[model samples]
Structures are given as C-alpha cells and as structure tokens.
Target: MARLESTLMAFRAKNGFDRGIAAPQIGVQNRFVAIHLVGKHASPQEDALPQAESELFQHELNHLVGILAVNLVSKDLLSADELLNRFPSHVI
Candidate 1:
C-alpha cells in the first residue's frame, strides 16, 4: 500500500493529476490498489475524480486478474516477436 501510495504520489506530482494505482504497476503480483483524494477531490461520501475512481479501480482489478491493457485492443495488435523486434536493443 505504501509503495502504491508513493508511486501514485510521484505520478500525480509529475502529471498534475492521478486517480489511483495498482500493485502490479510496480511489479507486485498482488491485488492492491491505492486511491488518492485531496481537497475538492475529496467529495462528501465519495471521491470526485472526473474519470471516476471506480473506473480506475476496475482497470487495476484487470491487472490483478492477469489482464494486460494490450489485451483490451483487438485491432492491429503486434505479436510478441514483432513487438520485441521494435525494441532498441532492450526489451520491455
């Protein structure tokens, strides 16, 4: 949780805004999510994320369930070999 919080904080600091983060985003193969709400974003009885915190949670949930973001797309997707070939002598 702490790591997620720190990562989320750093992301928000760099990007100006962030809704949440998942453990997998930091290479943790566990199910954990961290949501941040501050000042006006801390709405009464709810979080006031314009993109919706629930949606962010759902995105993270997909990661916990072993669903990659790339899998969500069905058009012009690259195979492992093809994707790896585009790497500049380093692998993702």
Candidate 2:
C-alpha cells in the first residue's frame, strides 16, 4: 500500500486536489482501492453508511469500464438535489 499512498501524495502535490485514486488508474489488478479524505468535510458515518458501501463499489466498477461519476449526472436526467434525495437517509 506504500506505493498507492506515495502515488496519491504525488498526485496531490501536482494537482492540488485532495481525492481518492483507484487502483486501475495505476495498472494494479489486485482489487484494492484507497481513499484519501484529508482536509475535507466528511459526512456523518451513520447517515452515509446506508449508501456508501454500494456507492463505493459501483464507483470502482464504473472506473473499470471507463465511466465516471460526472457521466451519471446530467441536468436532463435529474438535478443534483433530486439525485441526493434519492439515497436512503436515516435523518429527516
């Protein structure tokens, strides 16, 4: 995992964006992924748990097929707020 961390650090240094990088981007087929949430606003664990696991897996699967999150969101299909509201939530 050292190599993954190092690569994430290097990308952060060069791109100035703090986000996670999937293993497929680096040609690793070990089915491992890393997320770097440093210095970001994180959602509450309880609230995020319902959808986080499925979302994370779907996200990685999308990457494997060259699809991105942005591609799934379009004003024609659904607004951002509408999409956010579709996820199951514990708190009203």
Top candidate on TM-score is 1
Instruction: Report the C-alpha lDDT of model 2 over 7-42, residue by residue, as the tens digit.
Output: 888999999874566777788866666666434445
lDDT of 1: 0.77
Candidates in order: C-alpha RMSD to true structure? 9.7, 7.3
lDDT of each: 0.77, 0.68
List the candidates' TM-scores in order: 0.57, 0.51
Tens-digit lDDT string for candidate 1 (1-92)? 88899999999899998877778879997889787754455458864445665567677788788887788986977778987887647764
Looking at model 2, residue 67 earns an lDDT score of 78
Model 1 TM-score (2 dp): 0.57
What is the Å distance of residue 34 in model 2 from its true position?
Answer: 1.2
